[model samples]
Target: MSDVTPKHAAALVALDWGTTALRAYLLGDDGAVLDSRASPAGIMKLPAGGFDQAFDETCGAWLASHPGLPVIAAGMVGSAQGWVEAPYVETPADASALVKGIVEVTAANGATVHIVPGVLQAGAMPNVMRGEETQIVGALAGDAALEHEPHGALIGLPGTHAKWAFVFEGRIERFYTFMTGETFGALRDHTILGRTMRATAQQDPDAFIRGVDTAKDAGHAGMLATIFSTRTLGLTGQLAPEQQSDYLSGLLIGHELRGLNEVLAREQSNLAGRTLRLIGNEALCERYRVALERFGCDDAKTVADATERGLFRIAAQAGLVRAAVRVN
Candidate 1:
């Protein structure tokens, strides 16, 4: 860590380092982005002793320039196999819990990088998340209503493993994991359902909605039972090859939400009228929005730049950025 910073504007350097990709952010005093960077070098993708190299390559210059400008990293970079394991904070965990669980990795030059810990909901059916904790914090930062939603809000992070976190009073209460995205990928790439499917750049919203409606009406039989209809509809000419992929995607996502609603119903909480915030890619969140509407959920929106905001929020919590004001 050398003192090479030019303007001294950057207050923090944050990294959302996950399984397949890593993104870095330089934040100002107000948690605004001053600069940013990214790479494909995730923890799982790194080679032997490559973490140091990847770290240096991705944000070395920023760190070099800022010297001790607090560096904070979230995601798999803090997992058991990451640079250093940051232990999981249990459910009902808040930003304070994440700060308490922070672990550090020291560079050869004695620079310290703070790694944020993941959250775990311990129970018979245990659920865990790493990088998403930061995203959740970011979502909360973006919306005040979600933090205090009377019945708690559902924050959906849709991807390979979709996460539905139930937030109450600015804390992560409990969550559910839907393997919807990954299942769709497997069925599309390896299963017979993929054989007749054709890839296209154009989207078929009609076909997608149809699949969602079908899932809502006939999904009570369970996922495995209704999932097979994807191929049948195609075989019967109701779904074209080009429409099969999107249809299958809709089916999986629809089923995921259906299950989520059911689980909420069991807990005396319901998703139908709940305030839901989604965090993920634009198109994917839009798709989930449509599916949620189909399930009678009228209030759902996407939170942009959740990861960056969450990283900064956590960094500030850990006294890494935005130094506290002292009373005169």
Candidate 2:
């Protein structure tokens, strides 16, 4: 009711509200990014109703610049912790089902706003994911290599809680989330690992690969034994304290790979002739690729910024924006 009207009614605004920051993208009808803005407001930072204020401040800045453009958002912003708790649609959902249109939220000034719903997976066990679904779908759409193929694709999204999903015939068939990064953080920083190693030694690729190989060979139960081996190796003058982080990284990555392997094996019969794609941080993707290769799946391809590209593609398919946006 502030009396501001947008220059164009059809302009689309896409927001990626993450754990640490809030980012907004202004897109034209063709999905081209016209302008962008961001702020320090993230859901993790604001444990309370802080999201409402953060969102208002961030989007207010964008509205101040564009006058009155309709906005659509995805990610943790749709969770119970966000500005408005948008419910999640189950997996194997299509673009139409997945694309929960803008839910009108009232701003501090009484202006109307909208939020996008996250994706949830259910069965004997229930699992949920926010924000990454857009990216997963977007990654599938952007990769023409995937579209040309007829079979389903296995996508791995690495993060604090890494997600692995299957996309078939333009729908998300099923997915799983692993608390790899979070577990690593907990074990390294909060546990005995932190006390025994330097902060900077956590990312050694050699150690990571060794961990994957160990997990691939021994399975998850073997992690405790392996973890203790690091200490023993260091005590025996066989492994350095700096190398202790690598040892820990190996144990965690290995455990995660073991679980992922089980998921792949169960789904393999259903996927007789499909391809696998790894999407996440470059280095992490490489780690997955190495682990997967040992399992005899040689066709895994890796891509960067897959989530952003995936979100853009979903927006395009929903007609929220046009398909001409270059998602680089």
Candidate 3:
């Protein structure tokens, strides 16, 4: 085989193969995103060993246009359910330890490819993360706040499966995962809450504030009773359908906030002295900021796509691409 030519050497591709979508990002050596392509070939939609075909079909056309560019994949594409399983590396492992090259997978059409690895946690009840870790790394890279105080920052990533990571000395020290989104979905759609609450209501900030106050005072032990109150309130004609949804949202977000509050209280006793950064969708982050303020922590900020940027940072740090590059 001959050496990679100048054309190949000039550019690199980073694949953020999420569970629901396959995103191909073309980045220059300086880390700027020159172009991007996306498809619905997420791992969740594929069958066993389905990534081989999905990745090829998704990227083949693009690769044909720009031949010989090396691709580095991250996220669910490296899971046991993905085309290739890149086993998890534990906490404190640097970008290089988790860095994996192409897996040389053979597609149905005989095309070759590669996949990234997920990070694993070791303990009695072991935990693991596939693609999101890369995003967290990317977020850390872009945030001067996180970079400066790498040892004592708590990151809240809100989504279906919200992730809270503790970074110490620029390495992931400890982290916890919560099924906030899944739980809320189950409660709203599958439980009694669905009957009284409409999913389309605009969240009422007043109700949300009430819920936060209740959470800080009542804690998780009172959640079930609080949840049932929504139904009771409707029966008594005290809560409207819109208010019911707000109540439920408050209950779930409050539960999450309480859990996080406990962690923060224990982790940082001097809460008045430090700042807690919240990164996620703007709307959701604002809601969280309101809740955090209710608990006496007034300093919070929300930023969008912190995860994608974080993942890109990890890719660059791992030598998959050039560092300090900004992707449009």
TM-score for each model: 0.94, 0.82, 0.83
Write the residue-wise lDDT of candidate 2 on 1-328 in tens digits: 2325332333566788877888877665545466677887888888576766776676666666555555667888878877888788887776677665445577675545556678778888877888877777767765776766554666778778988877877778888888888877888777766776755625666665666666667665666666666567667886667767776766676676577666667745422234677777787777767666655667778876555565566666565444222221
Pairs that collide in candidate 1 are 5-65
Ranked by lDDT, top first: 1, 2, 3
> How much is the lDDT of residue 116 in candidate 2?
64
Candidate 2 to truth, TM? 0.82
Instruction: Report the C-alpha lDDT of model 1 over 54-172, residue by residue, as the tens digit.
Output: 88887888877767777899999888789999999999988999999999998655568999999999999999999898999988985776866777878999999999998887889
Clashes of 1: 1
Summed over model 3, clashes come to: 10
lDDT of 2 at 147: 64
Decoy 1 TM-score against native: 0.94
Q: What is the C-alpha RMSD of each candidate to the true structure, in Å?
A: 4.0, 6.0, 5.4
What's the distance in Å from true for residue 39, model 1?
0.6
Range of the 10 consecutive residues with the lowest summed lDDT in candidate 2: 319-328
